[model samples]
Target: MLSALQLHSRGWRVSVFDSGSAGRESSWAGGGILSPILPWNYPEAVWQLSRRSLPLYDALAPELAEATGVDPELTASGAMLLDPDQIQAGAAWCAAAGLAAPEIDAILQTRGPSLPGLLLPWIGQIRNPRLGQALRLRLRQLGIALHENTPVTGWLRDGGRVAGVDTAAGEHRGDCVVLAAGAWSGALGALPVAPVRGQMLLLRAAPGRLKRIVLDGGRYLIPRRDGRILVGSTVESAGFDKRVTGAAREELLAFAVGLLGTEAAGQVETQWSGLRPGSADGIPYIGEHPALPGLWVNTGHYRNGLVMAPASAELLADLMEGKPTQLDAAAYRLGAGRL
Candidate 1:
């Protein structure tokens, strides 16, 4: 959808094909944290894409709301790193990225003395479901054809270059075809993309009970404006099985209450799972296919699909249009060797 929007904005007659409802995958099930969980841990390339995409989301949400009349609820509610040991590394990463350093959360430390945290005031979030709705609406307004439940079975090959895509409905030919099919990208061919399942639970808490997104250990809790707090997630190599296991639910519920205290324990509203598009080397394939002409991929984002989608789409569109990209595109190519 991000790539479609970007291409459409650039005057491309765009058509989006999805096997299921838009955003029902990781995009819908994600906690919607804009920044990476830990910025210092990823490759420099990942950080570069994230740094570029993070700020774009701040404006993109409102712009969509104005254009599509669906408020995505993009919130600069900030985030907290609930571990003192990570402060130095997080600060260093922020400094290297030219972002303001995270501050010591003295108040959280005062309350939870065992786990001191750092405050990153610039981190933001979006309500994923609402964002998905807004994107669909915006695409409709732009006259872009969205073939929901229309699975692209394969590619429409021409003599030398290429034609477009083949779907269950029929051939939806275009100037270019982008395979942003998320975890399902592998179904078309051996694209080195697989599904990594993540389980999450939601807690119904009082509004304003939790102000900022909180991360501790490997778990996170995202507070919504409507008093729904999302606690997640377990990264498992569970293929495409999006089943919410009981063990995961129990563990996440305990983790949430452990951080927010037992008063918010029994308010567990819902639990679900999503399959992230895991790549071979943990980086997305975002360039033109080496073997197939007029074909491109923008998947393998894993957990950072929401974090990296904006800039990924921008970069993919730039490559498609033969425009100079904002960042080097060499690192995200599809095939092994280069030209």
Candidate 2:
């Protein structure tokens, strides 16, 4: 997206194709943790993406909001992760990373409903829906055409190079086809993008409620500035079925309410599910297609799509521009017959 925006700034005619409405997928569905509060459950590469892209938003977001006239709400209000024994481990992680540990809750507060936690001062978040809208607006303003509800059916080939993409609306021609189709990517027959379903809940909170994001174990609470808290997510390989089950919803609600009390219990305004495009290892696939020329990938971000967008775009932009990649593209390269 950052690259598309940059290229648009340079007067390149860019077009985006989505199987569904653009940006309505996990891009908008994410919890919007701009991150540093990321759990130790993630790998170093994931952490590296989080560490790098978290700060890039500061430089690019205002420009994007100004250019698109959309308020992609981004804020650095710090974060807190709790899990009793894990809290001490997290403290070491934060301190080792050179983040400012606020004296707000230095000692381990007795585990009330949830486990003990500490606020990681360098963390941040964004309103993902607002960002998707902002990017769509920006793309439109830049004269970028988008074909929503029309997805690539297959590839129309011409020997070594990819000729065009076949969609439900018939054949759409492009000099190059970049796959940003997210989870449905694996359905493309040649793309390595696989669907990883994640179910999340949107909760309307009481006034002056939870101050920071609280993530304990696998569950996370992403607080918006508008008093809405996004509690999510279950990572499951349930194919393309993006169904919101009663089990996940019940467990998530019980967890969040356990921390913030019963007042936030009846505040569940809505519930939904979306799929994160994951790879075999959870990093995004981002290089030239081994089978087809003039093709590249930008999917398989798993749950990190929103946080890694800027960096992912940068890597794609670098490759598309024939510039050297700062990160190793070896792992990201499409393997033989693996798309």
Candidate 3:
């Protein structure tokens, strides 16, 4: 949506396509964790992107809220990681990567409080459903064409250049085509993307269950302003089956229960799943095809699609406009995995 807004603002006619309702996929389902709760594990480029994007939330959130009449609730609530081993490794990686490691408050130990958690002081989060709602409303205000419930069957190309897409209704022609189709991105004819499913459970937080986001190994407990503490995200290669299974739910429950005290575990309200586009490499595919002409891609964000959305739009729009990009957008190209 930010990409569409950026491009449309540049006087380009932009159109977005989605199989379900717009922004109903992983983009909407995410817990909106920005920056590394364990940022040290990933490459420095991702952190750099968040550093650029994290500031924009303040400006973008209010502007989007005013324009769309929906506040995305972009909050600067920090994240806590309870892995001492990962923290040590993360500090070493930060120094090796030529980045500054955030200061740690080691004195905050409270009579050996459960376990000493490393606090990522610069992280941010957004309410994803609200972000999606606001993005859609903003796009509508801009007169950008939104083709929801319209799945692209294939790409229509002529002489190596992409002309448009072959959809269920008809072909929509464009001088330049940008595929921001989220998780279903790879399977679109020549695009080499596979859908990865994630099962997440949403629980209403009891009073003061958790103040900040808690990362305990595989399970993350994200608390929202409206009292919905989202416990998520099981990474399974179930091939686009966006259905929550009993096994996955039970696993999340067990993990979450271990993290929280006895009473907080009982407040788990609902469970659901959302599919994310995953590549063999965990990095997202976000550049133009090497061979295809007049075409671009912005998919394969893994689970960070929501967090990366704002920055991606700015970068992609810069590429489309033939202007200088902030990051080396070409780094995220579809190399051997070209569809």
Q: Pick the candidate with the highest TM-score.
A: 1
lDDT of 3 by residue, 118-170 (tens): 66555668998899899999998889999889888877887778999889889
Poorest lDDT segment (10 consecutive residues) of candidate 2: 107-116
TM-score of each: 0.95, 0.90, 0.91
* Model 1 C-alpha lDDT versus the unseen true structure: 0.85
Tens-digit lDDT string for candidate 1 (1-339): 999999888988888899888778889999888887887887767777888997788779889999988898999888888766787788777787677744554545624566667788878889998999999999888899889998888888888655788889999777788989889887765588889999999999889999999888889999999988999999999877888899999899898878788987789888999999988666788988777777888889988888888999999999998899999898888876422
Span of 10 residues, lowest total lDDT, candidate 1: 102-111
Residue 277 displacement (Å), model 2: 0.7
Per-residue lDDT for 264 in model 2?
70
Top candidate (lDDT):
1
lDDT of candidate 2 over 47-117, digit per residue (tens): 77666776678887897789888888898766776766666667777678777665435544525534446
Position 48, candidate 1: lDDT? 77
RMSD of 1: 1.8
TM value for model 2: 0.90
RMSD of 2: 2.6
